[model samples]
Target chain A: MSDSEDVLATAAAWRAAGEPVALATVVETWGSSPRPAGSRLAVSATGKLAGSVSGGCIEGAVADAAQQTMRTGSPQLLDFGISDERAWEVGLACGGKLKVFVEKLA
Target chain B: MTPALLAALQAAQAAKRPVALLTRLSDGEQCLWPDAALPGALAEAAEAALRDDAAANLTLDGEAWFVHPHNPPLRLIVVGAVHIAQALVPMAQTTGFAVTVVDPRRAWATADRFPGITLIHEWTDDAMRALAPDARTAVVTLTHDPKLDDPALDIALRSPCFYIGALGSRRTHAKRVARLAEMGHGEAAMARIRAPVGLDIAAVTAPEIALSILAEVVAARRGAALARRAAPAPAAAA
Candidate 1:
């Protein structure tokens, strides 16, 4: 299938399989985050997901929150910023904040 | 290896296309091991280990579960056969999105002007099957007519179409929402419809507006690091 069809089908299948899946979206970003506006990540209850919202900096945090949202069916807005205090060598360099609005799919 | 799995891997290795592998990790589904680009975002050794144990990793919106990274191209789908589309289509196409412009107006969607693009002169329903709008793809309705835009948005939101934008004014957007209300879409769903689409940048001409709109779409598409960093910031860091 095409890109659009592929993503929809993948997401639908994940939902239909009873997998608690949450959608991660880049609502707002600060500086030089890896992914872009419509970039999305779908995380399953099993901690499996598709796509990328960042190069990889905030994936771990986003996945953890998405798993929580998927099970609770509660949408959550997750924010991540690269800071020295919370300096994660694996985090983004340009120090931008990414707001990922996660929602569970029933 | 299954043909589908093999093709997906090949696509990634060759940069032909980006495909996601959806495998079931729990017993709810029959997915034993998903041999994805980032099968649980594990290292090659770790992913192989997951495969041995019949487990799978997670990913979405470019975030992987384990720890690996893979970057792919953006996909933009434009709906309409208008002047804005004429500008936006090619502009976005150049920006690396696999652009496909869908319109029932054959006269306007011909290839003479939109040469390399995947132009579809068909109804939205027919084209949507192929155009599967997702978080990676931006769906813009420039038809300016609700009959065309509304139906497309209806299907778009139902699917994982991430960015659903329709061209109109703020007043037009309010009016459009009222009409959509009759269709049973609640405020949340309506909120997803970015009417009066594009950035707040002052863009008047077709080219200028097209650039601004595409810029916003890119802004919405990029990750926090790349999108938020202003020009000077990245330079300073460098």
Candidate 2:
């Protein structure tokens, strides 16, 4: 299955199971970002995750933000760039920039 | 999540139809746009997105909407389970085409020869009818036998298949053309078949021939516009 389909299916399954779900989507990308725009990551309230917005470079941060979005019932936009020293710590060694939108699925 | 929207998306995916999911990122309002059946409410925006076959953010009436195009995988239908097919099947699959090898010769079209691929043990005409080639489908006839290749070419020529290739030499193709003409197909219709199949790469081996054929198919699919642009301009009037 495609990444979008996988994320959608996982989100639907979580919603059916009475767990709040939030979806993170890569809205924009620059340079050699591992994933392209429209890449997605689905996170459930219980910390379960499916799909990917990055090649493990920034998924942890996105998941944490997604879980927070699920709890707050609000959306958050995150921007990550390799220019930041912290990006190296997070493993974005490809020197690209990406923006992800995290929102609770209603 | 709206169950109706999800159901519609899944239905289109199951049918191998192209679809686009338009989402209003601000509020998570979503709608499904199946190809050629865009909702009247968002016809213009959806049409634009489908044309590009790419996901993009569109602002219509000052609302930001992201259009995610979900296209079905491309398909390749080989009309003969010959030696070339043994090499071609894996190459096409690796290039992301769902391939099916069709041949009535059960002895040749065995699972041992084409493991993990769809093998259709039916006549060329019957199999082509059942598998209905679409715009994203490529049809090739590797069998030199006219009885096998002609029927497959007849169906592919009439269909909207993007590429139609037939394996033969120039002299052999001339004979095949005469037969097709006798079958009532006009020159315009017969022109669709890529006679003497594959690019002129002097390919003699099975694998080399398969590579040339696939290269031609890919060029047909993605380089038509570029090929047109590269064509020499007509002589200027003196």
Best by TM-score: 2
**Fnat of candidate 1:** 0.00
TM-scores, each model vs. reference: 0.51, 0.69
Candidate 1 C-alpha lDDT tens digits along A2-97: 232344346657767877677665655667776654367778788776877788777787888887876676667566776544426446666776
lDDT of 2 by residue, B1-238 (tens): 3667767877787786778787777777777775446445566666666666567777777877777777776799998999999999988887768899999999889999999989998889999999999888999998899999999888988899989889987678778888888888987787777867888788999999999888888888886542121222232321
Model 1 chain B poorest 10 in a row by lDDT? B24-33
Task: Report the C-alpha lDDT of model 1 over B1-238, residue by residue, as the tens digit.
Answer: 1334434544563573433333221211211123433333334533453233222344444543322112344667788878888899777766767788888889888887688788887788678766777666788888888877877877777777657778998777777777788888886687677656777677899888788778778776654332332221111211
lDDT of 1 at B53: 21
Error of 1 at B84 (Å): 1.3
CA displacement after TM-score superposition, residue A52 of candidate 1 (Å): 21
